[model samples]
Target: MLNRLSIRSIFLPTLVGVALLASVGCQEVPVTGRNAINLVDDQDISKKAAEEFASIKKMQRASRNPAQIRIVEQIGRRLSKTVFWDVPHADWEFAVFHAPGVMNAFAMPGGKVGVFSGLIDFCENEDQLASVIAHEIAHVAARHTHEKYSQGWMLKPLGAATSIGIGTTIGGTGIYVPSVGSTAGGGVTAITQSAFDRGKELEADHIGLIYMAKAGYDPRQSLRLLQRMEEDIASKGGPTANGWLANHPSFPQRQIRINELMDEAMSHYEKGEVSRTHTVIE
Candidate 1:
């Protein structure tokens, strides 16, 4: 059995190693200017994202509506150009998936964006749709996926260390402790991860609002979209924003944040060249 000195020796090196990795992995997130750790290679993540996007396209039905396709592509093209410098290596592609009643959109690394038909239909105007797309694109630009992978990589060793520490502390007492540390570590990890994810979602909103404004869409539409979504959720008896495990911030929280950033976003909008006129989606 490893003694206290042996455990200390291992723990100290592990911590030093983690610090070294963190030092090397830190990068600035675009728009938000926040330092983020991204140890994974972008090319590798992009390649995997492309493959996964392809698989999703096969599983989900693609929308055939010409107008839906047209608007998505149009807004996507504008947003892509706006974010080009931030995502310089992106090979952007946008597709609209036919999933009625499912209001969601997503962006993967390397600029793979998918918008659901329900989301498109729910949007009051083209600008609101642009808000959603811009938010997803912001996720890619901010390298959130890469950061998430890097976090997972770092968490594994920390979790192991926690288990070791717990075992060492209680093993001598001869009480049951096999799952104790692991359970506690896992709960802590989950809460930490959830908080991290929620923060990322808000960061994405911040970045995306700027992206939409720079792309000539009205940034205020994003707030309106969130309000509408919140009302719809309440009407349907869906989950509230207070859930501890939620990965995204509550709509009200998001709106508040967006409101705080509105002036800056509006400045960009005032200076940005208009790319397209508003179109009502029927």
Candidate 2:
């Protein structure tokens, strides 16, 4: 049913990609047991992320509140130390911006993280702030963005690449890969990519819960934060949340899935608390 050239185009890249993935892409997400797609190296992504993060920090009005800023850095440090780096390295910084017009936070590769003052307003306590920050860090930890860039041609399955140039899977929706360089037929690609993006957001939520729990923050607070975010988004009635909803699953769906992961996350919290309380002083 297949000839040599056809097989070469199909299986060769897949094999090479998989091999690269084994050495580079097989970064398992902490606590999620998901093996990430390796389209880029951590150092490479972190370098780029650091550049972008610096640019963003310059553009925004950084918060002057010493209290808020200190809190942000403290929480970030607590979580960052627990990161499971196959090649352990520390390059973490956390900042709080005083932009009331914005209500969000994000973490970049290289351990750079930022939170907006407006977002902090919504967070009722240190735990709630931990909820949001851990979620953003989870995105970095999972390498979601790099995996997205890597999904197109490299990940295309050999069997599917025979009929179509390359294909990718997103949220159980398998995209029909277009012929190489054919942007004209990318509508399905966009939609499928979007679905995968939403899936990544949900995955971050799950993993973030574990990170915060392990860091001695209760994961249930994240659920409360999400619940409030949902209400706020509904009230605002638009994309005022800064494209947060655009690539994310519906608020209700996120809430439901977070509810599912609650028990496991709480277990981590209980364990973490016990471990913390019993720290021996020599």
Candidate 3:
């Protein structure tokens, strides 16, 4: 009983409706307000991060310097108190790895932070170190990595309805792609990763300054740390010699913004009501 014209009318409208729903089903990122296209859930990312973390512990030497570990832990705790008091589930732990050649610091979801010994060489003192930890913390608080995963979920389909259900699995273990470093596979991922990564870095800079100020250190120390890091990298020839430069904003650009925010951060530091005991290390 179906004529060609009648069938065409039904098929065309159904196709358009599906297209519209497909477009609306993508997840939106927190803080940055961008839409993400991902297939994996947060539990997936968290599981992977935990597995990778365990693997790292098996392969690498954690720092033996208890004093240094305590210092870093203190900074992390103070920052958490001010910036992430709402994240009750945050199992905040700071560890110093013994890799002096690998200048790296990164935070996995759920507040697992690692700082390498090589990075300490770049920090002039606690404020500088706090800047690094604060930035990593921002990544976790803002859920930037999870946003990246959500972006991937939208573009790929296990099946339309199945994929839609997975979008709710938004946070999980950190998974890094060995070759391209966690975000090497998709069109949306590449475009948004750069923009989101850069935005998160800038947000960290701003929010980290607030943490530095609240913690009773000169937020200007953030700029100083980046300057020192740039010089250190230049002396070493290039970033390949050190892992600290692995994923970060360029020295000049980050330094410029930090400088711009210095005075405002200093005012907050001066006005902070708490009788803080944080020491400004040389």
User: For all the candidates, what are their Cα RMSDs to the real structure?
Assistant: 10.6, 9.8, 8.2
What TM-score should be assigned to candidate 3? 0.68
Model 1 lDDT, full chain set: 0.73
lDDT per residue as tens, model 3, 232-268: 6567576554232335566677778778777877888
Which candidate has the top score in lDDT? 1
Give one digit per residue, the lDDT tens place, for model 1 in 1-282.
999988876676557547847676688999999998876678977887777678667766889999999999999989999999999999999988776655666677888887777788889999999998898888889988777666555655544423321111110100001111343322222212232367888898899999999999999999988888777766755653223325567778889999999999999999968656678887
TM-score of each: 0.80, 0.73, 0.68
Model 1 clash pairs are none
* Model 1 lowest lDDT segment of ten: 168-177
> If the candidates were sorted by their TM-score against the true structure, best first, what order would they fall in?
1, 2, 3
What CA RMSD would candidate 1 show?
10.6
Q: In model 3, which range of ten residues has the least summed lDDT?
A: 170-179
RMSD of 3: 8.2
Report the number of clashing residue pairs per model: 0, 2, 23
